[model samples]
Target: MARCGSKACWFGLGMALGAVVGGACAMLVRTATQERVLRQRDAPMVPSDATADQALTVDATDVVEYRGFVIHVFCHALGMGRFKALCDIWESGAVVLEGGGPPTTHVTAEESRSAAIAWARQWVQRNG
Candidate 1:
């Protein structure tokens, strides 16, 4: 029969204990994270009255409407060429306009401005 040394036995025991400790630590971390998420979900929903009037934040964006006068909201850089080309080729008199800057939209200033003025007049007549 072979006899095991104290050092070898202690090393094997230490390795086994380390693996168990590591697994327990991993489980503990996962449970803590789940508990935190659950706590957040249980929190109360804030009432609308508690906040300021969100309606005051108006979206002053440009839009082009069609025969039905439906709003076609877009940005300012969608040039006359693409829209007009599309309409001319397709035989559709659809409106195409947008707000300021390159990123906002792609409507050309010349075409968009003309349309914008027309839009303003129409808006005033209808609203007034």
Candidate 2:
């Protein structure tokens, strides 16, 4: 058998190591993301010890027109005075698409609304 000091040997070793490490990193990321989503989804929508005020200062949902489609955005409260967004895209009063963003909560309902609108705009550009 030949010696193990060739470039091919090192390349193979590097590739194998990279694959193992990459797989591990990807799994870790996926697990963490799932855990985060679960925690955020299951937690309280508002703080328990906070004063009795509305979670949102404005209406929870609104509809706007964009790119010849209707975009309905809803802001949902998260704990610690944060918010996330859910969106619905409609054409002819029937939904064409829908999505939600939870891991990206904002400090205000308006902010969440803006983020949802931006996301909807990009989605429209890409898929509509």
- Compute the lDDT for candidate 2: 0.76
Per-residue C-alpha lDDT of model 2 across residues 1-128, encoded as one tens digit per residue:
64668899989988999999999999999999999888755365556755532544345477889888888887766666677788888887788886644348788778888888888888778878
**Each prediction's TM-score versus the true structure:** 0.30, 0.56
Candidate 1 per-residue lDDT over residues 24-103, each given as its tens digit = 99999999999988877324344346433222123324444434343433222222232211111001354332332222
Count the clashes in each prediction: 11, 0
Note the Cα lDDT for every prediction shown.
Answer: 0.42, 0.76
TM-score of 2: 0.56
